[model samples]
Target: MSSKELTDKLVAAIKSGKYDAIICNYPNGDMVGHTGVYEAAVKACEAVDECIGRVVEAIKEVDGQLLITADHGNAEMMIDPETGGVHTAHTSLPVPLIYVGNKAISLKEGGKLSDLAPTMLALSDLDIPADMSGQVLYS
Candidate 1:
């Protein structure tokens, strides 16, 4: 399904108050970025941005915490300035780690992608395993 559809369902789920946790991944940026078409990537970002506001509102209604982060960077450097060619692969650049909520969650610095797991667990009020390598991003 498209990002809109997925987001709509998520909003409904959030409003329903049926679950303690909800997780969503919009594949538009990553999937479209893989095509190495800058124009398409722009549209993809616009679409994701449009959907995010609705999500933020729903999260506020439920007084829930939201952690928004991408697995990797793509479409940001679609055109390789050095090679003057289309870059179709993921970039090594750091991805954004955004937290949205009424209650503050202090984001820890030096957090890696692995930190997402621990962060989610913390948000859900679940215990973190001792062997887990990822650090909790919020305290």
Candidate 2:
């Protein structure tokens, strides 16, 4: 589905007030970036940006939190420095991990993906399992 459609569903779900946590992935950035079209990539980012605004509003309505993150920054660079063509592969760049909520959360800097689960559990007021591979992202 398009990012707009996906975000619409996400907003609806958030408004339902039936969930303690929600995870969303907008494939537009990575999937469309693979096409190696700069204009398409820009449009993809814009689409995701718009969707994110809607999501933030939904989260506000429900008094929930948002954690926006990604595994790779595929759309960050679209030009190949050597070949003069579009960069179509994922990069080694650090991905973003943004948190939004009313809670005064103090997130640790330089957190890795493994920190996500523990952070989520801590945010939910649940104990981080002893077997969890990472430490909670609170400083």
50-86 per-residue lDDT for model 1 (tens digits): 9999999999898888888888889788998899999
Residue-level lDDT for 103 in candidate 1: 55
Tell me which residue pairs clash in candidate 2: none
C-alpha lDDT of all candidate models, in order = 0.88, 0.87
- lDDT of candidate 2 at residue 60, scale 0 to 100: 87
Error of 2 at 8 (Å): 1.3
* Candidate 2 weakest ten by summed lDDT: 104-113
Candidate topping lDDT: 1
Candidate that scores best on TM-score:
2
Give RMSD (Å) of candidate 2 vs. truth: 1.3
Residue 11 CA displacement from its true place in model 1, Å? 0.4
Error of 2 at 34 (Å): 0.9
Cα error, candidate 2, residue 2 (Å): 1.2
Model 2 alpha-carbon drift over 4 Å, by segment: none
